[model samples]
Target chain A: MYAAIDIGGTKIAAGLVDSGGELLARHEHPTPAEEPVTAVEALLGRLMADPRWERVRAVGIGSAGPIDAAKGTISPVNIPAWRDFPLVARVAEATDRPVTLAGDGVAMAAGEHWRGAARGRENALCMVVSTGVGGGLILGGRLRPGPSGNAGHIGHMCVELDGPPCPCGSRGCLEVVASGTAIAARVGSTSAIEVAEAARAGDAAALASFDLSAKALAAAIAGTAALVDIETAVIGGGVSKAGDLLFGPLREHLKEYARLSFTRDVTVQTAALGGDAGLIGAAALVGHAEV
Target chain B: MYAAIDIGGTKIAAGLVDSGGELLARHEHPTPAEEPVTAVEALLGRLMADPRWERVRAVGIGSAGPIDAAKGTISPVNIPAWRDFPLVARVAEATDRPVTLAGDGVAMAAGEHWRGAARGRENALCMVVSTGVGGGLILGGRLRPGPSGNAGHIGHMCVELDGPPCPCGSRGCLEVVASGTAIAARVGSTSAIEVAEAARAGDAAALASFDLSAKALAAAIAGTAALVDIETAVIGGGVSKAGDLLFGPLREHLKEYARLSFTRDVTVQTAALGGDAGLIGAAALVGHAEV
Candidate 1:
């Protein structure tokens, strides 16, 4: 069995997963917004209390990044109190087992590549298009977390040279135009879910907002395809739940941007694992080193 | 020893290279423009006529792309007559040695990673920024040719979603804005060399043109860094000869674009191999499979 932990802005989740990618036990706790480290420790304690913890051979932790896998540290954007936190060392000390670490994006890709839509794909980009867009890459049939564990940080790539300024200090980043936050901001809606509801009701403003986000996503995806020669992209998260509202326009815009011969046949697919992906991916990271 | 061939739109050059990547003997011929295959065969025959050919154990060919390494075929954009031409099969038949094929960009990167600016770097981007921009990537201490061998085709990556139309049918590609052709067009000059001369003479328009191209290049480089976590970018080709006329502005803009912690330290260096990168890189391809 593998022990998995997922550190996010709002929640700390832990689970015990078997070799077959099955989650046998799980636990979750709301993240202490101002003090996430303490919450992580508490969540770890709760998970260890389960009898299955003794069966765990390795522990894998997936945290929002920028993570330094070499240094075993993480500094998630939404968690102000955890800048450069030594996650791997602390977790290994607490669990008393060998530990592996990866960025959330990397974890997500690992999970999908191991058992989700990206399974059997030699090269793919798996993405989480939530409040902010996040992603990981599978290259040469292996999940590549990159040296710093940020190989698939596609959200920050500049899709527009002169589009708009992003909070990450770059202009025209894909996240600024394609994330759920961006989609809501485009239609002046409170949330992407609300915008989706409006679009379902035939609201032109909401539909156009989704289209704009899709256009930016298409450009970024096509650009990635050109750079790495990936032919498939698996998308998940709240914004992706909008279904055809996003994929339809995304596919349409992809046709326009992915015009190069190698990139022309690029395909988009919905992520199959949903919210469980982070936990499943964290578990998969325990074995990823062999790949 | 290895045999290397570089097939460009205007020239077909072949060389005998030692295991240490030293070019022993070489031959070249201008491409027939409309009948490049014949020129390539003639160049290969001349290269084999050298006594050094007896020492060669393998052959590597780097050609203008988009090349289908899987199919052992080439369909260069500039050489329309060679669509899906089976260059690898023909070369292998003539040479009677195992043959390897890669895009020119991949060859350039392999050469640089083997003996040039990117020699010791674990992850790097090696580029040829000429009339058209091209590049290849080194990841995890090895060159990655990607599935179709176009992994480092950075020129086609869109920096601007709504920028300008490229002949490849994409808008705002890095090549559309940062290629030597683009730089010269910005200054109403016939060539980037002429623009460089004018900029050296303190022409304001020429200086602005270089800056604009540098800014685009900086954005694309930063974007690539964010996507793949590469810290070093080695640039070659005619436009890179502009020196600080290009590097100064690129470094300045990189500071504004590469703001993420993992991407913040991206360093740009001039490619050390120069024009011979393609040849040496083609030679490098013979051993890339083992990596």
Candidate 2:
């Protein structure tokens, strides 16, 4: 048995996983943003209280970056209190088990590659379209986390050289155009779901916003396909639930920009694991490391 | 002994390499644009005439894309006659040796990582600034050529949403701004060397053109650093000879656009191997397979 944890800016989710990719137990709690230590303590309390924790031999934690995977440290910009936090050590101390660390996106890719949408694919990219856009890569059947565990941070890849100024100080990053936050900002809505629903109802303003976002995403993906030569992209997260409202324009833009024959053949699909990908991917590390 | 060959749009270069990365013998010939088979055959004839060919154990060929590395076929856009050409088989038939194929940029990265500028680095990006811009990646001490051996085609990444349209049909690609071709076009010059000389001589037009190119290149690199978290980028090829004319502004732009603390620390440097990288990298693959 293995324990997998997905640490997000808003919440902490833990799950007990078996060898065959089944979830035996699951729990969630609000993440403590006040302090990194306090948050870990709260998570540890929850894990220890669970009966399944006693049988798990290893633990995997996935969080937002920029992270130092080698040192198991994280300094996520979204969660300021985690600066230089020894996340792996803290979790290990609390759980009394071997621990592995990775960025949330990388974990998601691993999960998808092992049992989700990318199960049979050799080269693929998995992206999360939640509050923010995040990405992970599986190239040549290996997970690429880069030197500082930022290899799959596709949200920051500049898509619109002149579109809009992003929080990262770059202009027109994918995150600025295609993410949930970007959708909300563009439609003057409080959440991405609101924009999705509005577009579904044939609202011109909302549909245009979705179209623009999807086009930007498609352009970025086409460029990425040129760079990495990957044939498939697996998209997940809350915003991906918008479905055809986003995919139609995305396909059209991809065809418009893709010049290389190999890149033109690339396919984009929605992720199959949904929200459970993070948990399953974290658990997959126990077996993947041995390979 | 190893044989490395760089097949470019304008020229073909062959070098005999030793285990220590020294070029024991070298040869060059203008690439024939009349027909694909004839051009390849002519190059092969010259390469076979070299004394080093007798002792060479393996062959490596680097060419323009879009290539099918697994199938050993090439279909470079500039070489219109080479559509779906079986490059590896023909080369192997002529030389009676095993051949490995990679993109020009990937070969350059391998050469640099093995014995040049990136010798000690485990993760780095090698960029070639020539008639066209191209890139290659080294991650976790291994060459990453992606599924079709086209992993580091960074030049095509969109850097400006409103920038000029690229031959690839994308707008604002890095190649459309930072390549020697782009620089020449901007200055109405015949070649990159002329633009570089004019910039060195304090020509306002030339300097401005380079400045714009450098800023775009730097912004793109900053975005890549945020995604891949690499430590250094080793630059090579003809345009890189401009030195500070390109790098100084590139560094400034990187700092301006870099929002994450980790990305701000990425170092950009010149490639150590001047011209023999292609052949050396090809030879490096004598005992290796795609990774």
Candidate 3:
């Protein structure tokens, strides 16, 4: 058995997983962003005290980056307090178990590849289009974590060289165009759900906003297909919840812009694991890690 | 021994390669884009007449899209006469050897991964920034040909959503901003060399053009690093000959925009193989195909 932790800016989730990638027990808590170390320690302590924790042999963590997977450290952009935090060592010290780490998007991709929409697919991209656009890759049947565990930061890839400037200091990144934050920002709202509802109600402004976002996403997908030659893209996150309102337009735009025959064949679909992907993928690390 | 053929719009290069991926002998001729089949046949005849052909066991071909690698058919966008042409069968008939085919860019990546600049690197992207931008990928130590073998068409990725219309029917693709064609077009010239020379001579317009191209390319590289998590990018082709004029500004832009630590770690370097990359990469196909 293994323990998987999905650490986000707002919430921290923990799960007990079996060798077959099954979830035996799960729990969640609001993240204490102000006290980063204490928050993580408390979360781990609470989870470790649970009856399910007795069976856990290892721990896997997925966090927002920039991360040093090799060193098990995290320096999340949103979590300013987590500058070079020793995530893996702290978790291991608290739990007395082996630990592994990866970016949140990478963990999501692992979950999808292991048992979700991208199963059996050797080359695929798993993306989370939420508050921010994050990505993870399964290329040539292996997980690509990059040199610093920052692989799959697709949101930051410049989609429009002259478009809006991203918080990362780049212009026209996919995140700035297609992320839930971008969507909300476009409609002058605070949540993606509002934008989705507005678009569904035939709000021209909302619809236009989504159309632009979808086009940007499709363009990025087409480009990504060309770059990595992946066959499928499994999309997850809040923005993906818009369903056809997002995917239909995204596909239409992809067909228009996908110039290469091979790239045109790429399929973009919703993720199958939903929110559980991060935890499941983190657990999957115990079984598959080199990728 | 293996026979490798690089079928370009303007040239046909054939090489005899040993098991160690060395070129034993090489031949080159101008390609008859107007009569691709005849040109290919003529090249095959020349290759077969060589004594090295007697020892060659298989033939590998790399051509421009859209090719059906599984069916060994070619329909290059630039070679109007190659629509649905049975290139593999023709080559097989000519050489009396088994034949395999892939996109020229894919083959280039395979070649680089097998014995060139990308050797020992598990995940790398090899790009040719010549007349038009092209790319090939080695992901997780495997060559990615994608579904239709037209993967690695990085030049077409939209870097500017409203920058310029590409021949591929897309607006603001990376190729429109950073490719040799795009650079030359921006300068009202016909070749990247002229643009490079102008930039070298402190032509303000040319320097600005290169800077813009570098910025676009840097954004794309940061994006690619975000998606695939590769550590190194080995760049080749005529445009790369500009050396520091291109790379200096690219690195500067990347550092400024690549806020993610992992993405910031990505190294962009010149390809080590130089002009021989295509032929050597073609020869590297033998080992790649077997794998």
Candidate 4:
């Protein structure tokens, strides 16, 4: 068994992952968001202290960006206390096991590539379109974490050249257009969940927002296909749960944008694994390395 | 020594290349454009009959696309006489040599990556922005040709969300905005060469056209950086000869589009090799494989 940890802004999760992509024992606790760096490490320590960790051969961590896997540190935007924090070293000290780290997006892609929607695909782009969109890549049959371990940060890719400015410093970033937050803010619905409900109730404005978001996503996906030559894109996260409401328009727009012969046939599929994608993918970082 | 062939719409070039990226013997023939497929093959046969061919251990060919490199066939848009023509087999039959094939863009990139501007860089993009914009990629220190061997077809990547339509059935394709053909058409110039001269002479419309083209190229480059995590882009061909007139605006616009921490400050450089980029790159396809 391998121990997997998924670190995010709101929560810290730990699991005992088996070879079959199963989480034998899983635990989670709310993150003390306003606390200092030690508070988060303390939560990780408590989780590792669980008796199941003794059976683990190695530890894998999937943290939010911007992670430097080579340096074994992370500077996640959501977590303020940790700036270039040595999460890998801390985890190593806590677990006394070899620890592997990758950005959360890359970990999620690894999980999908190993046992989820991207399974059996040699080249794919797996994305999570939630509060802030993020992604990971599987190219030439392996996860490409790039030099900085941020190979698939697709959220920040600018699709609309003259589109609205994004907080990421680019104009018309995919996250600013297609993310759940973007979808909710399009018409001030307060939440994407509410927007989905409004769409279900035949609100033309709500439906239009989803359509607009899908169009931006299609442009980015198409551009990615043109550059990197991918035939499959796997999308997950809260906004994706809207199902056909979002997917219906996404596929339609994809046809318009992915017009090249090699790109036109690219298949877009929903991510099979749910919330645990981050945790399972973290485990896959080690699993895949061993192979 | 290796034998290299570069086939395009207007010319067919042949060269004998040494291990040090030198072109020992070189010759070219204007393409008999209005002739049959046999005429093109005969030209290739005549070139291989050169006394220099005796020392060549392998052969490489870079052809216009859309080429099915795996099938050794080509269906170039400009070469209507040959639709999926068996150029690879015919070349092999003509010279009895082990042949390797790649798109012209990939060949140019491989050439530059092996010994030119992209040298010493693990991840880079090499592009040719002549009549049309074409490109190739080096990812994790290897050429990525994708499943179709057309992995870096950057010309068709749309940068403008609501921009102009392109001949490739896509809206705002990079080629439609940044190619030499686009530049000439944008300013009603007889040729891009003339447009460049006019810009140097302080023609307002010509200057604006170049700026527009630079903006589009920058958008595509920025988008590519965001997707693939590349920090360097090497540009060549007709339009690139404009130097700072193009590079200055491109770098400026890139900063606007490639705004993320990882993507910002992407370095743009000019191609080192001149007209022979395709030939040397074709040889590199074999040279790199041997290493």
Candidate 5:
């Protein structure tokens, strides 16, 4: 088994995952998001206290970006307290085991490719559309983390040349139009859940917001299919929880942009691992070098 | 030595290539583009009539797409007489040598990656922006031709969500906005050459046309960098012949779009092998399976 750590904005989750990619045991703790580095480290210490800790052969961490996996550091957007934090060295010191690091997007892709929606597919893209949008690539049957560990940032890719200015300093990023945050803002809601609820209640404004987000996501997916030849896309996170409300139009809009013979054949499916995909993917990074 | 065939809209060019990617001897025949398939085959026979043919061990053909490299067929847009032409099997039969096939764009990219401006860059995009824009990818130190050999069709990848409807049935493709054909059409010229000369003479309309094209190209380049992590882009073809007139604005506009750290570092360079890149890349396709 490997000890896996999944760091996100809301919380820090850890688990022991077996070779078959099943979580053997798990623990979770609220992130001391604004506290010093030691608080998070202490949370990790608490996570490893599970009886299965001794069975872990390696430590794998999947953190939000912008992360420098090569430098074993992360400066996730929401985790202001961990600026370029030396998480890998700290984890290695505590576990006395080899540690692997990758962006949360990459970890989600690896997890889906290993045992979830992308299983058996050699080339795929896995994405999360929550508070922020993130993505990862599976190419030629392997997880492509890229040099800076940001290969599948489908959200940041600009589909609209002059559509809208993005916080990444670019204009018309997919994240600006398709992310859960974008959906919430467009629908005049504080959360994606509220938008989903409004849409379920058949509110016209809410429906339009979901459709617009779906269209942007579809365009990004089609563009990715054209560029990299992905055969499938596994989508997850808060926005995907909207289910068919987001997916039906996403499939329809994909046809509008995916005109080429190759791109037209791509398939879309919801991620199967739910919230624990990051944990499982982090574990795979420990020994599955390609992932 | 290998036999290399570069099939394009205007002509059929064949040459003998050495192991080091050097062209030993060559022959060019204006495409009997409107004639029957037999006329083109005759041109290939004449091309191989060079005494250097005896040294050729394999044959490679790079044709304008949409090509089915797997089925060994070409359906070049201008060469309508050769729809789904069995060029590979016919070449093998005539030369008694193994034959390989790739799209013209893939061939150009492979050629550049092997011996030109992209020689040392493991992750690069090589493009041709003449009558139409086309591109190919070099990923992880080798050419990635994708499933149907159209992985790097950067020209077709949408950059502007609602810019314009392209003939390829998509909207705002890089090709429609940035190709030499587009430049010529925008400047009310029959050819890109006239547009270039007009721009060199400080014609305001011609200069703006080039700038628009450059911006489109830059956006496509930046988007590709964001999606695929390309380190460099080597551009060729007639529009590229305008030199700084095209590249100057391309670099400038790239800065406006490539705001992400990984994409900002990407460099753009002119193609070194000029027109011969396709022939050499076709030859590489024979033995380098990745290409």
Candidate 6:
């Protein structure tokens, strides 16, 4: 058995996972947002006291970025309380087992590649298009976290060279143009779910907004295919749940952008694992090298 | 000893290279633009007759793409006579040695990574910005030709989603806005060299052309960094000879586009091997797995 922890801006999740990737017992807590590392230590304490902890051989952590896997620390954007927090060391000490850390993006990709949409694929890209766009690469059938464990940052890639300014200090980044925030901003809505509801009710503004987001996503996906020759792209997260509304236009625009022979055959699939991807992927880190 | 062949649109180069990467004997032939495979056969016959060929253990061929490295065939866009021509089999038959094939872009990057500007860098992008932009990647201290031997075709990646139509069927591709052909078109010149001369002579049109090209190159490089976390980019080819006319603007624009912590430190350098990169890279293929 493996112990997994998923640290996010909104919540902290803990689970014990079997070798087959099944989460046997799960626990969750709303993130304090301003709490220090003690909060995480307390959560680990609860998990270690569980009887399943006796069977756990290793611990895997999936944290929000920007994480320093080399330094075993994280400085997530939304969590203001933790700047370069030593999560890996603290967790290892609490659990009394080997610890591995990966960015949430890398963890999601690892999960998808291991047992979900990208299964059996040698080269794939798994993306999460929720509040923000994030992704990771599966190259040669292994996770490629790169030097800083930030290899597959597809969200920040510039698709429009002289387009609108992004919060990341660049112009025309994919996240700025395609994330749920961007989709909401396009139609004067408070959230993308509202936009999706409007689009389903035949609202023109909402429909056009989804179209534009799909176009931007197609460009980024096709660009990734050209750069790395990925044969499959597995898209998950809040936006992906919209189903054909997003996938229909994404497939249409992909035909226009992915014109090269090698890039032309790329397949886009809905992520099969849904919300459990983070915990499953975090546990997967125990079997792979630290990202 | 290695027998290296670099097959380009205008010329075919053959050389005997030692293990140290030195070109011991060199020969060149003007490509018979309309001729069939016999021309390459005749050239190979001359190369085989040389006494130095007796010591050659393997032969490497780098050809203008689109090449099917897996199938050992080539169908160069410029050389219409060879449509999926079986170059590898023919070369192996003539030389009686094991042979390998790679795209010209992959060869140049391999050459640069092996001994030129990108040498010692584990993750780098080596680019040639001549008539068209072409490139290859070095990841984890080795060349990553991807699944199709075209992993680092940076030129074809879209940077400006709505900019301009590219010959490759995509809009706002780096090649359309940044290649020597693009520079020449921007300046109403016959070639990029003429634009370089005009820029050196204080011509506004020529200078603006180079600046725009540099901006596009910067966006692509920064985008590449975001996607793959490449640390170094080595620029070569005809327009790269413009020196600071191109590099100055590229560095400045890179600062603006490469804003993420992981991407910000990317360094740009001039390719050290110049024109000989193709042959040397082709020869280096004897040591790597098929792209």
**Per-residue lDDT over B138-238 for candidate 5, one digit per residue giving the tens place of the 0 to 100 score:** 88888877877777877787777776788778787788889988898987899878988899999999999999999888878887887778899999988
Clashes of each: 0, 2, 1, 0, 0, 0
> Model 5: what is its DockQ?
0.67
lDDT of 2 at B209: 88
lDDT of 3 at A122: 86
Q: RMSD of each candidate?
A: 1.0, 2.1, 2.4, 1.9, 2.2, 1.7
Spell out the clash pairs found in candidate 4. none
Better of 3 and 5 by lDDT: 5
lDDT for A156 (candidate 2): 84
**Residue range A1-291, candidate 3, lDDT tens digits:** 889998888888888888788887788877775776776777678778888788888998889877888888998887888888998998888899999898898888888888789889988889999988988888768777765666777888787767888887767788989988888888899888998999999999899889988998888888888787778888999889899999989999888777676677789999998878889988876666733
Shift in Å, residue A190, candidate 2: 1.7
Stretches > 4 Å off in candidate 4? B34-36
Model 2 CA deviation exceeding 4 Å by range: A49-51, B46-52, B285-291
| Residue A123 error, candidate 4, Å | 0.9
Could you give candidate 6's per-residue lDDT for residues A134-252 as a string of tens digits?
88999877888888777788988889988789977999999988999999998889999999999999999999999988999998999898888899999999999888999999999
- Per-residue C-alpha lDDT of model 2 across residues B127-163, encoded as one tens digit per residue: 9988888888887787777767667888887776557
* Model 3 misplacement above 4 A: A46-54
For model 4, residues B129-235, the per-residue Cα lDDT tens digits are: 99999999999888887776677889978777676887767787788888999999988887888998999999999999999899888878877777788879999
Would you estimate the TM-scores of all the predictions? 0.99, 0.95, 0.93, 0.95, 0.94, 0.97
Q: Which candidate is the best by DockQ?
A: 1
Chain A TM per prediction = 0.98, 0.94, 0.95, 0.95, 0.95, 0.97
Q: What does candidate 1's lDDT look like per residue over A47-105, in tens digits?
A: 78988778889998889888899999999888888888888899889889998998898
Q: For model 4, what TM-score is found for chain B?
A: 0.95
Better of 1 and 3 by DockQ: 1
DockQ scores of all models, one per candidate: 0.86, 0.64, 0.67, 0.68, 0.67, 0.80
Worst 10 residues of 5 chain A by lDDT: A35-44
Question: How are the candidates ranked when ordered by lDDT, highest leading?
Answer: 1, 6, 4, 5, 3, 2
lDDT digits (tens) for residues A1-291 of candidate 5:
888888887788888899899997777777775664555567568757877677778888888887777788888877788888888888888778888898898889988888899998989999999887888998888888877777788878777877788888888889999888899898779998999899999999999999989988887888888777889889999899999999999999888888876688888999999978989988877755633
The DockQ-derived docking category for candidate 6 is medium
